[model samples]
Target: MQHFICTGGCDGESSTPGVCQAEDCKKEGEALTPCNCEDGLHGEVVEKKDEDED
Candidate 1:
C-alpha cells in the first residue's frame, strides 16, 4: 500500500524515503494522482509503502 505525508513543516524522518512533489501543494481538490497521499494545504507529500507489498 501507499500513502502521502506532509513534508513542508516536517523535520527529517528516519524512515523510508520520499521524493519532492512541490506541485502537490494545493489543497482544493482530490490528490493530483491516485493512491497519492497528499496534504495540499501544506507543501509536502510522502509515499508510505507497505512492507508486505513485496
Candidate 2:
C-alpha cells in the first residue's frame, strides 16, 4: 500500500495525493509525494503500555 505526504515536510498525509495544508506549504501550493516505505512506516515511535502499569 502507498500513501501521500507533504512535499514541504508537513504533517499532511493521506491515502490519496492532495495539496499540503501547512501554512507555509499552502502558500506555495505544495503537493503531497508518494510514500515509498512499507505502509508509510516513517520511523514513527509507538509507546506500548503495560497492562498492570495503569
Candidate 3:
C-alpha cells in the first residue's frame, strides 16, 4: 500500500513509511477515501491487484 503526506494539518491517510511519530499524523493504511493532512501534501496512491488480473 502507498500513502502521501498530508500538509493541510487536517487528518487522513499517512503516506509516510513506517510509524509516523508526529502527534498530528493521521495514518490510514486502508482502502478508504484519502483526507487532507496539512495542505498541498497529498497521500500516495495505493494500487490494488484484482484477482482476475492475477
Backbone clashes, each candidate: 1, 0, 14
- Please provide, for model 3 over 1-54, each residue's C-alpha lDDT reduced to its tens digit, 9 standing for 90 to 100: 445443323334455544334454343333334444344334343334235422
- Residues 1-54, candidate 1: write the lDDT tens digits: 334443332323222335434544432222232233244332234445335422
* Candidate lDDT values, in order: 0.35, 0.58, 0.39
Query: What would the TM-scores of all predictions be?
Result: 0.18, 0.52, 0.20
Candidate number with the higher TM-score (1 or 3): 3
In terms of TM-score, the best-performing candidate is 2
Predicted candidate 3: what Cα RMSD to the true structure?
10.8
What tens digits encode model 2's per-residue C-alpha lDDT throughout 1-54? 677776444557778977777776532466666775674554432124335422
In candidate 2, which residue pairs get closer than 3 Å at backbone N, Cα or C atoms, i.e. clash?
none
Candidate 2 TM-score versus the reference: 0.52
TM for candidate 3 is 0.20
